[model samples]
Each structure stands twice: as structure tokens, then as C-alpha cells.
Target: MNSKKVRILVAKPGLDGHDRGARVVARALRDAGFEVIYTGLHQTPEQIAETALQEDVDAVGLSILSGAHMTLVPRVKKLLRDNGMGDVLMVVGGIIPEDDGRELINNGHADQVFTPGEPLDNITDYIGSKIRS
Candidate 1:
């Protein structure tokens, strides 16, 4: 078995105060053998991108329930790209509408968007596959 472990940063961006889902997912990712970093709450796009760069994380998983994903998600993506961290995998979760999720993917804001109630394993598997590929 490969001994390498993936590092992921799980952050709650914008004014979203509901972090229950983010906390659950972060724990689940850690249990799945990922080195997970949970960035409390109310993080800005620049802060998230900066953390991802500084931590040298393999991926960034954002948990946003504020319905401002349309703005925040893309901004983070842009900042990462601008900071030359464009290679990192970007994934988002929490209370997102299907159309918005599709738009995010189509516009390159995120590689995947997980909705509420999706199995945690699905997220782990997706990140694993994307990183290994």
C-alpha cells in the first residue's frame, strides 16, 4: 500500500456561521486517512488561498452555507490561480443548489461540489482519485 498521505484544507468561508457540516466532513476526511486542516469559520477567499499555499495542501475543500458561493467560490479559485496555486484541487460542499454547483464546475471554480447528505466516503474517494490522477 502507498504510504503517502493526502493533505487537505477544509475551510468555512464568508459569513456562514453554521459550521456543523464542515466540522463533520473535516473529521470524516481525517478518519479516511487524510491530513485535514480545519480553518474555523468566516475565512476570506484570500485567507483560504493563502493557507492552502502556506500549508502546501494537496487540495482545498470549502464548506459554505451562506448562499454566497456564487461569489466566494470563484474568488477563491481566482486567488489560488493568481498566487500560482492553480494546481491544487478545489472542492466545495454544503447547501448548494444544483444549478449553482454546475456553474461552479463549468466555470472552473471547483472540480466537484457535494450537497448536503452525500456520503462522506464519496468526498474522500473523489479527492483521492483527483489527487492520484
Candidate 2:
């Protein structure tokens, strides 16, 4: 059995100063036995992608509530792909609209779009299933 912990980078991108949810999620993920890197507030997409590469994480969780997901998710996704990290699991959580979430997934911008009220187990279980560590 592989004992390597699933590494995840939790990033807060853009000028959205609200990070309570991101922190909460990060903590829960840590408790769930994943190695999580929390990049504190106000991060650019470039920085996020760079960190993802540097950390060699298995997944990235983008927590955005600034209403800039439409612009940010794509930019980050592009950067990840550009850097040859395209297969890295990409997940976004925030106040995204239902249609927008579907569009993000449909458009291949994100592997999953999670909105408010999703149980922590859902996130943890989904990641555990998708990624074998």
C-alpha cells in the first residue's frame, strides 16, 4: 500500500480578503490526513501555478469568493496547463453560480466546482476517490 499522503494546495486568489471558508476547509483537509499547503490571502494566478509546481501537489483547491472566478479559474488553469501540470486535479469552491459551475466543468476549466454548504466529507471523499496516495 502506498503511504504517501495526498498533497493539496489550497489557494486564495485575487483581492478577495475573505478567507474564513478557505481556512476552515484547509484545516478539515489536514485533519482528513492530506498534506495541505495553505497559501494565505491575495494570491495571483502565476504564484498559484508556481507554487503548485514547486510543491508537486496532487491537487489544487482554489477558494474564491471575490466574484472573479470566471477570470481567475481560467487563468490559473491555463498557467497549470502551460507549465505541464495539466493532469493535476483542479477543484474550485466558492459562491459560484450553478450555471457557471457547470460551465467551468463542461468547459474543462475545472475538474469539480463546489459551492457553499457542501459537506467536508464530500470534498475529502471525492479527493480520496479521485487520487490514490
Candidate 3:
């Protein structure tokens, strides 16, 4: 077992002033034994990408409940890709429609899309498996 913990960046983008979900997930990730760096709320794509790069994180968990996943997730993915961090795992959790979630994954913008009521263990396990491989 590689005892090294996975590093994660949990970000809330757009004008979503509500971050209770983001905070919950960040705490969950930390409890799951992953090193988490929260980017706070209303962060730009550039800022998220830069922080991920600077922190050398292995994954990014985007929490967007404002229904801006289509616009924000892709932009963050693009920024990370352009900055040579495309290999980093990108997962989105929010109030996104199933169709949009499928689209985001189909387009390779988000590795996975999590919705409300999803167990934190699912996210943590998925991230652990992905980063471990």
C-alpha cells in the first residue's frame, strides 16, 4: 500500500454564495484520509487551476449548486488542460441535471458528477481508486 494520501482541491465556482455543500464535502474528503485544499466560493477558473497547480493536487472536486456546471466545469477543465494539469482528476458535485452530467462526462470535462444524497464514501472511494491507479 502506498500510504501517501491523495491531494484534492475542492472548489466552488461562479456566483454561488451558498457553500454548505462544499464545506461538507471538504470535511468528508479530509476524514477519508485525503489532503484537501478548499478554494472557497466564487473562484474563477484561472484561480482554481493555478491553485491546483501550485498545490500539486492529484484531483479537483468542483461543488456548484448554482446550476452553472455547464459553463464553469468546462472552463475549469480547459484551464487545467491548457496549463498542463489535464491529467488531474476532475469530479463535479452539484445540482446538475442528469443529462448535463452525462454530457459533462461524455465531453471529458468531468470524470464524474455527483448529486445530492450521494454518499461521501462514493466520492472518496472513487477518487482513491482513480488516483491510486
Candidate 4:
């Protein structure tokens, strides 16, 4: 039993002001014993990657509802990799179409994309299964 908590940085990038879902998921990850850092709102890709690097997090969870997924997600992913945190698991959630989500995964930008109505437990389980390898 390592006893180390998995550190997760949950960010609401772009001009999206709606963060209720992000907050709920942050709380859920915390409840699941992961250390969660949530950047409030309107964060730039540079800001998100900088925060993740500074926090030394194991993963990053992006909550995007702003219809700017294609533009924002990839930039953030590139910055994360550029900052030498490429191995950090990146997951996205919120109003993204299935095709778009798959494209993000296929393009190697995202590790996972979660949509609305997804069980919170599934997110927790997925991260738990991937973290310590």
C-alpha cells in the first residue's frame, strides 16, 4: 500500500463560466482519495499547463462546455507535452460530440473523453486502474 494520493488537476479552460459539473467531479475525486486541484474558470492553456507542472500532478481533468473543444483541448495537450509532462493522463468531460471525442483520442491528445450522464464512479475507476502502472 503506497499510501500516496493521486494528484489530479481539474481545470475549466476557456471562457466557459459554467463549473457546477467540474466542482461536482472535483469533489467526487477528492472523496475517492485523489488530491484534486481545480483552476476556477477562464483559464488559458498556458495557465493550465503551468499549474499542472507546478502542482506536480499525476493527471489533468479538463471540463469544457464552451464549444471550443477542438481549439482548446489540443493546445492544452501540446503544452502539457511540451512542458515535459507528457505522461500525465489527460481526461476531458462535457458537451463534446462522440466523433470529436474520438478524434481527440485518436489524435493522441486525450486519454479519455467523458460526456454528460456518465457515472462519476467510472471516471474514478478508470483513473485508479491507470495511475500506478
Per-residue C-alpha lDDT of model 4 across residues 1-133, encoded as one tens digit per residue: 2777889999999999989889999999999989999999999999999999999999999999989999999999999999999989999999999999999999999999999999999999998788976
Question: Candidate 1 at 39: error in angstroms?
Answer: 0.8
**Cα RMSDs of all predictions?**
1.4, 1.2, 1.2, 1.0
Question: Given candidate 2, what's the lDDT at residue 132?
Answer: 73
At residue 41, what lDDT does model 4 achieve?
Answer: 96
Work out the TM-score per prediction.
Answer: 0.95, 0.96, 0.96, 0.97
What lDDT score is found at residue 126 in candidate 3?
A: 95
Report clashes for each candidate as comma-separated counts: 0, 0, 0, 0
lDDT of 1 by residue, 19-133 (tens): 9999998999899889999989889998999999899889999998889999999999999999898888999998999999999999899999999889989989999888987
Taken over the whole model, the C-alpha lDDT of each candidate is 0.92, 0.94, 0.92, 0.95
What's the true lDDT of residue 60 in model 3?
95
Per lDDT, the best of the predicted structures is: 4
Candidate 4 segments whose C-alpha is farther than 4 A from its true place: none
Error of 3 at 115 (Å): 0.4
Model 1 regions more than 4 Å off: 1-4
Error of 1 at 112 (Å): 0.1
User: How many collisions between residues are there in candidate 1?
Assistant: 0
Global local distance difference test of model 3: 0.92
